[model samples]
Target: MKLKQFIAVAFTTLCLGAGTSRAQPVELTFANALSLPQVEPYQRAVDEFNAANPDIKVKMINTPWVEYWQQRRVDTASGKLPDVWLFVPGFGAEWLYGNKLLPLNKYTDADPTINLPDANQTMLKYMTLNGKLYGIGYDFNGQVVYYNPKLFDEAGVAYPKDGWTTDDLATAARTISKKLNGNGRKVWGFAGASAEWVFEGWFRGFNSRMITDDGKYGANNEGGAQTISFFMDMIKDGVMPIPDQKDPNAQAQSLFIGGTAAMALGVGHATYIFSDAGVDFGIARLPVGPAGQVGTGLGGAYVISADTRYPDAAYKFLAYITSGPVLAKVVTTGVPARTSAWGKLSDRMTEFAGKVQGFEPFNAVKGSFQVMDIQKRVLSEVWNGSKDVPAGLAQIATEADAALAKAAAK
Candidate 1:
């Protein structure tokens, strides 16, 4: 329970000066879901900010990820939202449509200290709805392929390079698995490719998409078949595992970390996980699809509530936390939304320098999570050989279209 209860707080000092002393500093409630090591840097930043600004104090409320979001929804309904909180990316449509957030464009535009351009446009795009900015991004994640070079060398397989295509990925995976198998090693060439987020990239590569431009399911066609077929072929070739249905993400990560898998499709923060495992890995941009390279992209941003009584003080803290210097220290998992802060990351994440700039968000559509769930169920059947690609995709499209329509009706 201690892991779930970590909170960041700093004492406020009433400054002694000509007509500057106040009975109480303006207190702002700041909330985030980060726990443990991730929250350490964030606490330090809040303490530093509180010490520097005697007039304003930020009290941090930290909770586990699911509990935090559940609490946020309750707070939003009760009209008692935090003065400022982390605006998770996928919740954009829900929060914005529900009028739970205050548009920060005026604050960002007027503040001379705010570096709007330092934030990645993709992250900003998620925050923006109808041309109005809702928040300032603190950090972001972009997808990439993580490969173990030691496994590659041992298997005598050449390392994957940027701009490699799906065909190229298949070849490399097959070669590595084949060579390692011949050597009596139990390692598979890749893991986690069937993950919904990772699969979205391959969907793009094969000129298929999860949703149409009009926001309906788009994965019910030839291109969708090709993408599904490609993944099925990888499994049939024994290059990748049939994903763990209950939690494919964890399964993929653990397999790679435990050395049973040689490569994985992951996001920017995966460098930390792999590095902690002492794996010498190489990061490559997502492979090129028939159309072009693309993947799942999103991150967290700082947002003020529409109900906040102290917008000015809240904006100050938002700007402070999102500033390059603070983010360079606080953001340990993903790339800082600010490109300027990336230089502070260790060399192991060097592939992230400027590479995330090209990454664009695909899963930002309305009702995306609903559609993603449908894909997971139907695709799991396909991966398990219970359904053919065409039938699986048709089911996905049918079920996802209904879900999207139901969401719209709401």
Candidate 2:
């Protein structure tokens, strides 16, 4: 028989047999960096999807965050990528440019039921590459200052407010340190991590473009130099802790939680950690810098692999997982990307409703641009005080430009 005739006959046979014997469901793999403890909402969403779609089944794979990137690199090289995975736009740009992941425009545009339009346009813009949508942001977050109210009251300094400038932060930190330090207490006014994300927030505050609008390295410019110099001066002036050369995040968290530090720069989730640690803390906007009160938003996205055998099913699953109702539950650590889901998140924040302030500023600021990967090491040198700010940023520009050029060539 001809191929068309055989297919017609096979379809009829399957239809006739459908009532008597069920067909095997299409199987797809979904992978992410979230650990088991943090994946309850995702698992629940998957369960609901599986229950509703008897013809498709999704298996979830989770890898530790520390090892996920390296493992994904190997998986991409071998064409072993899972059907769906989680990614960060800033870090996943090279992979998207290389076509390791599928462009989601066709899926999003063709599906009338898909709610991609409801996502924050600013965040959606970040997930786009060369005018093609590559992924959907699952959550949004940026930097905020978490302060100890008891410390503020004890030191007779008012809590930092939304429009406070960096100089104001320095003054508060200095006052707190002078009043509480010595006398065997060693209280620190501020604590910050040496991580790239933290530095990116400060850079944005100064209106510095780490990677210029045209995509060349520009971290050695005046704004960038001023940001680095300001933070280094904070450490030298004995207001902020000299961040640990290694594991700066852990050190900062320890100082803040142990009551040795009165203030710490952190993302939204810090509220929960401080609450759990029994710290009487309140949130505040990041201090306004030379440019204004601007900062960067860090978030995650859901991406599909280009080589998936089940593209249509994968797209359906993607839409299901990121839908407002599902994402409302999925977002525990950060703000949901969908405006519709914000109410659900506000409900979750009930524990600290009256105590915390400045969350409004985080929602208002959007990430300006993704920092180049090379900025981390060079900025670390400046933060750790081993290299002069000017010299380190100059080296950063050269190294970052070379890296960008090499990636472009690829």
Candidate 3:
């Protein structure tokens, strides 16, 4: 389609009924925050959707993650938001509560081919809030520890198993950190100890809640203190590095890719990076603490703007891209959000399939993003040993409770 034609179609906001016909195909603006290299798979799915449905043409709007939120805010205020855009449940709470996203329940109810029943219920539940479905999840992810077996072998430590305790993890980590390579290159035992989501995962493992079901702050107790102490001890023991608090994910990924970290806590998508780097690793469920195994879940979905002119076409594209087969093929890094796609996943993450739960409890609340901001800032101090654990947790509780109360007032 020509640029002019695409622009024209994007502004043509007629709600076409089911089975409606038109001489020209409906075009939609599909905005995504994925970076250039990471988006090829999604682009391929878009191409497939455009080719198969001659009646709909979806145009790509690529915004890298660094500038995505800023651009999205500008677009939203100017009434120029894309017809369909990507949504992250906890991170996009501002958009959700502002009522800028179109509810998908009606469309899903009318369209059987969308196959609402086939999606992972855990991911689907996150996409819905206050009885309204805002988006259809395409992929699901959670923080899991990926370990280097060679490092474990060299250190004479047993490889971490699915049901391993946090104590078992500490033993392996401490042992591995003590071993140096032939050239005397130091290899840390673990990375991602300071990452916000990874920290959340450990806290979950300790049965600590960051946010309660009632939407209040809940991480200021004994469990939260123990979780903090655990990771702090790891860093103090020289088993983990003090990561860049602002961008711990990148640092964690870098350490693991460089083979300087024997085991790293990362999201399910980090497998792709490890594979691309030719790193030898084994996936293990997060270690069990008193609460049993647990970790933080994060994922993305396709959502329509409430201001969209082409709701029908947008819904069509949303449904197509998020379907089982397309997601199974395109979402190589993360687990597809459809139950039927589970069988197609490779053996690397097969054990995690049906075993790990990817729903993040904080995403259930109204001001989670604000709460997370508080978490990231305050916990950085705690992680660096500049602030006491008890003090940090108390500050988080105060700030997060205030943020939630403010959001509730709105």
Candidate 4:
């Protein structure tokens, strides 16, 4: 072979090698606000996904919930949203309606391997907007009463059961407080927090709607007044903690874990926290009001950005996290959104059998609503006793109606 023939052959080989190296895997960014124990399940899912898909690389970005939304707003305005992110139904509404999120129907419908129909129907409804699915719910959190068994035993008071009413709750709380308050160890019947999401259960128990069907404030009505008055009476009766008694930083969970309170209304996550704390705790359904048992469901979903450069890759990651196998692993931290995943979750809970109770009540919660910022502000003022419930709720209706009207006009 001559020198010219050798050079030509070498050039061809070099071009082929460059083309092969250019076929690299796509990289995607997945952002979430989950921390610590709750985050472990998510990290596990991400690791499994990365291991399974060598052609796609997923980078997990963890942010605190407070800063997460603020940063998302900034990212949205500048069109720098991550390929995938975790979002609650209410907060994610703006992004979905603004066309900033990718509609997941095409991917979900075409994928035979994924049993999308097995997901919790109520949760799936929340993730849908304008007849299109925007995201897939990974887990759900619902309200339950976390009570100390030792406290109840010490007071000689029977533990609360399903169908117990507000009156019963007050009686039990009063009995527990009275029996346990004699010593230096101060004990309260209940620890109340200022979060509106938690109080919605009480309002619903009275068969009241916080926001009317028309989207205007409705908490000023008969049921709302009754619910508010009952809580206020409890506070006056010395059964529930007052605003000044609660530490701003250490909320209900901390109080319960410290054994300072006999009972507290908390989310499903409290079961895991209590179990980890080695507290002899039990869970019960929220005490019923005139109507029946009711509470609010809180959870989030995995979504893909509309502006993502790799739609297929992003969808794959979203589906992977919400799939039955992955969700089963995460369900121990919260309720699974997939009905099939519940079986595996039950198996996992065996390790925590007698330590935790009231999981059924959390799973039974099927209703939920999105409370606006203005609504939260008014409710907070009322809960803190700085404003009268009727007056504050009426003001909320007026302002909320005006805002809705203005938006409608635009």
Q: Supply candidate 4's per-residue lDDT for 309.
A: 93
TM-scores, all candidates, are 0.86, 0.79, 0.78, 0.74
Is 2 or 3 the stronger prediction by lDDT? 3
Count of residue pairs whose backbone atoms collide, per candidate = 2, 0, 0, 0
Q: Give the TM-score of candidate 1.
A: 0.86
Model 3 clash number: 0
**Runs in model 1 lying further than 4 Å from the true structure:** 1-24, 154-156, 183-187, 254-260, 352-355
Q: Lowest summed lDDT over 10 consecutive residues: which window, candidate 3?
A: 13-22
The global Cα lDDT (0 to 1) of model 4 is 0.72
Query: Which stretches in model 3 have alpha-carbon errors above 4 Å?
Result: 1-27, 38-57, 64-68, 78-81, 175-188, 250-260, 307-312, 328-335, 339-367, 403-410
**What is the C-alpha lDDT profile of model 2 across 1-410, one tens digit per residue?**
69999999999999888878977999999988996766887888888899999999998887898688888888888989889899875556667667778888888888888776687555676667678987787876666778889999999999988689989988898899999988678888988855455466576678785555455665578898888777788888888877776666667778889988898877667766777787777777777888876566657788899999998999889888877888888887667777777676544344222222222211111121223345656667777678898898888887767766665665
* Residue lDDT tens for model 4, 1-410: 69999999999999888988856789999998977777787778888889999889999999998899898989998999999999786555567657889999898889997787787665666667678988887776666677899999999999988778888888888899988887577788887644355555666778776655454555668887888777677777777766433332246777789998898876655667777788888777777789776666657788999999999999998888888887888756667777667666543243222222222211111122224556666656776688887887688767766665554343
lDDT of 1: 0.79
Task: Give model 4's TM-score versus the native structure.
Answer: 0.74
Off by over 4 Å in 2: 1-25, 39-41, 64-71, 78-80, 110-113, 116-122, 182-185, 213-216, 331-335, 339-386
Full-model lDDT for every candidate: 0.79, 0.74, 0.79, 0.72
Cα distance off (Å), candidate 4, residue 52: 2.8
Pairwise TM-score winner, candidates 2 and 3: 2
TM-score of 2: 0.79
